[model samples]
Target: MTPDLAPQGALDRAWQRVADREAARLRDLFAAHPAPILPARAALARILAALILLGSAALTLLGLWLLLRALGLGGVSGGARVTSGLGAAPLLLFTWVARPRVPRVEGTPLPEAQAPQLHALVRRVGEAVGVTRPVHMVLSPDANAFMGLHGPRRTPVLGLGLALWYGLRPQERVALIAHELAHLKNGDPTRGGVVQAALNVLHQTVSVLWPDPVMEARAGLPEKLGNLILKGAALLPLGLIHLLLGLVGADQQAAEYRADLLAAQVAGSEAKAGLLDRLHMAHLLDSALHKQRHQPQRPDAFAEFRHMLDTLPPAQWAQVREEHARLRVRLDGSHPPTADRLRVVQAWPSEPLLTLSPEDAARLDAELQPFVAALEAAATEEYLYRTSG
Candidate 1:
């Protein structure tokens, strides 16, 4: 006998109701603006902020140099001189703050020779998006796909999420790739990196000035007061840096909206929208799976994901959507709400230029099978370790 899917049916109805209610507004917004345009003020603010940071660092170093020279002149008592030298400790903090650190990416590289068809697909997508192909492609365990610059040379690397790939349709996968490639075409990675570096400096400076209370608890009252004074002094620059980061983040969000439009152009609105929906559902299910005390052993991760999707009740899906709808975008967030993204894409006129045949999808999956198997094993082991701990 067929199992009851009344809950699932109800959830589908609920989703339709939500989609329908928001459809007109989405369409109108798209009609007014077919493509996202970066706000000029935000762009200017980002550039100005970068310049200010550079100037501030230079001024700080000059001040430290003058202070060291004055200390070397030694007009005061030895004890006073030692205290003056100690006063320069905050100057040393800038070195920690301004030090440039490369972003660490986790995953195993997939050689082009091992996946010729996949590489070809990426090349086609890159061409359509007017961006150079990534120098390397890596398979990640997370349910996400992104492109980034790595190392001193800032070489572009594409990261394909195994779980995301397994859960999405072939065309949807193409749309995901197109979206990431759009980031490269738009030069978001480089711009975002600069903003991120500035923010990191600000954050580290704040941490140094206002260390954990627990760590400083045993200090004398005078020492505590001095730390508090330092924290108060650091707040102004921190606030300014945060504001600047917000402006940069707005541009980043605009870039994301633009990428969605580009993805729709490459893979069609339906495919892009479908991919978003599946991703939302997958995230919900993945969270639940993560919380389970005893995970089911599955050799094929893709098949396991398929089974999870097939068996998930509609009521649970509806709950996930409802909760998702309640999420708000923060001022410093790089991406807009997924609902907004979905609405914008849905309003876009359908024009799919890429389609993969079932056989082609199967071939791609076959190539990824070994990698997926290894990823799943690692994920399982990690989960076991976490649960046991």
Candidate 2:
């Protein structure tokens, strides 16, 4: 691989342009068939992911052999023994530290006991979307709803960011819930175990192999030379991570569109589009919360933001939509562009399969009353909406 010497951001921008083109291609490709399972690419991603971890495991085996030989199990002695032992330690440590484990779900827990009505509301939406498993819920202070798998059982988890949750009307919350739950059935790439584990392995390996600039700055000539060697070594895995991202890019984009399709089926098409409109105004939501966070006297951040969102000028909506199309920034780097997602959501219409009433939503809110105060307000993030642009 050629080392271009461009900073990482420059590299990211270059690849991102490549990614944007791919997204556009996939958006068109999926129009006739919105969500194909993409078995071929999925297989390739799985194989690549497996090889990454297997490579680590092979290194760990080598470390074991060296350790065994150092202990005189193979009758090796003295300088050889000392050298083998020294080398064995780091390799063994690396494998242990980086071994795949189920990642913990973020945000504070909202156990079924603590929020049973809330849990029930999510389940109602889940069943309508065809997810049969028991659901767990959590609360965050962000402006997003999420679907994550938790524990060894891979129990489905639903996360509600109170800011976004409170901002939504009862029916809108049904659309939000349905949209997220649909990800489980829509072939979300991150939900796949083999490929996700491999991604985790690749990320861990890259972090270890990539030379730290801070360390390089403080190094002597000998250490700098070692870093140079490491910098070269890092290219293999770094390039692999990029390759995997490219492989999954189009499929993941399709998965999101497919999830929107399912959301429209579960919640009405108009409601789903309305939820997306709120997402497009995420920056405004952040601005409202930021204003409250800095106020000398405290205010109900959710109410302040909700009022602002409710009264947003029609021109501002048009402006954000224009900005989205012009800039091509994704909600997250992983998502298809917001403008495109909105276009697809509006184009494909469906009747609501189920609905959440205001009374039911109130019951759910009452169950989550304890978390309301803590989760309602969030501090501003420079990339808060940038992350979800």
Q: Whose lDDT is greatest here? A: 2
For model 2, the local distance difference test gives 0.74
| Tens digits of lDDT, candidate 2, 1-389 | 11223336976778656655766766665555555444367567678878887887899899999888778787787889989999889889877766777866887888878877777777888899998777778888777888888888888888888778877877788889888888887666657577788777777776777777788889999998898888887788778877776666656667788888888888888888888888877666666666666762335666667777898899998987786665453212467776677778776777888888888878876776677566653334433545557
Best by TM-score: 2
Evaluated at residue 379, the lDDT of candidate 2 is 38
Worst 10 residues of 2 by lDDT: 1-10
Worst 10 residues of 1 by lDDT: 1-10
lDDT of 1 by residue, 1-389 (tens): 01113325776657444434433343345546976344465666567657756965775775576467548664676776566566556565665454546665568889898998999898888887777756578997766788877777777788997878877787898899899888888766234455656665666666666757876787789988887898897897688665775566556666777788888899888889888777767653354345332465555555667567657899987777676655544445566667777888887767888877778989998988878767776665665576676
> What's the lDDT for candidate 1?
0.69
lDDT of 2 at 368: 65
TM per candidate comes to: 0.77, 0.86
Q: Report the Cα lDDT for residue 129, model 2.
A: 90
